[model samples]
Target: MATGDEIWEALADFTEQCNNNKRLRKMQRDWTKILHFKAIDMDDSFTMKVVEGEIVKNDKGTVGTPDIIVETDSETMCDMFWGDINPTQKYLRGEIKVKGTQEDVMRIDVITAVIWPEV
Candidate 1:
């Protein structure tokens, strides 16, 4: 299992990469979303806020109701951010679980696909 700090670092790096990608930023333009991630293996939770086209805030604890909630093990979460794992496949195989509307879920998928294509 990955440590909480490692997961945080991966998310920070991933967010920076996404912010630097103009295409990806445009793809998510006007989107304001709050995302909650639960790393079951590490017993850690994080909340991220995406406003306009950038991830503006990421904190160690859940702050409020999220538009999307993602549940997975810490290592898998780290791997996903590192572009070493395919979120779609993991979701299909029950390795990752998500709770959100279809559109919101697809939005998350789109972000992942645009920033970190399957490998």
Candidate 2:
């Protein structure tokens, strides 16, 4: 199990990497979204807000209405954000659960693929 702090740190790093990537920015240029991530094995939830491809807010707790909600173990989340695991594979293996419109889900998957191409 990973601590909440670890997850937060990983999220921070993930956001930084995404924001720094030219291709990711171009791809997400028009994608504005609010996502809620819950750690199923722990009492922790995080919200990430993206606007014009930039992650404007990423912090503990749910901040607003979610366009997407994803649930998984804390460690898995940390691993995914740290580019240590492929989130799509985790979802396929039933390790991650996502509730959202098909478009939103696909968008998240695209983000993961771009961020962690080797994973």
Candidate 3:
């Protein structure tokens, strides 16, 4: 299992990669939202905000009422950020729980797909 710090680092890298992807930038052009992630196992939480096609990480706990709330273990969170795991598959298997509008959920999936295309 990844530690809390490892998960944070992975998320940082993930956001950096997402920001650098033109397709992702175009996809999120007008979308602005905050996503709060709760690492259940670690009892830690972090927030990510998407504004003006850029992903900004805020590891200082919940910033505001997040548009999306994702609950999962630290290891899974790290794996997903590293593109080593498919979040949709995990969600389907009931390993990850998400609270948000369908569109927002799909947006998360889109980001994941763009970051780590299926092989």
Top of the candidates by TM-score:
2
Ranking by TM-score: 2, 1, 3
Question: Which residue runs does candidate 2 get wrong by more than 4 Å?
Answer: none
Better of 1 and 2 by TM-score: 2
Model 1's TM-score against the true structure: 0.95
TM-score of each: 0.95, 0.97, 0.94
Q: Model 1, 54-94: lDDT tens per residue?
A: 89999998988899999999999998887788899999999
> What is each predicted model's overall lDDT from 0 to 1?
0.90, 0.93, 0.87
Residue 89 Cα positional deviation in candidate 1, in Å, after optimal superposition: 0.4
The backbone clash count of each candidate, in order, is 0, 0, 0
The CA root-mean-square deviation of candidate 1, after full C-alpha superposition on the true structure, stands at: 1.0
RMSD for each of the candidates: 1.0, 0.7, 1.2
lDDT of 3 at 118: 77
Model 3 TM-score, all chains together? 0.94
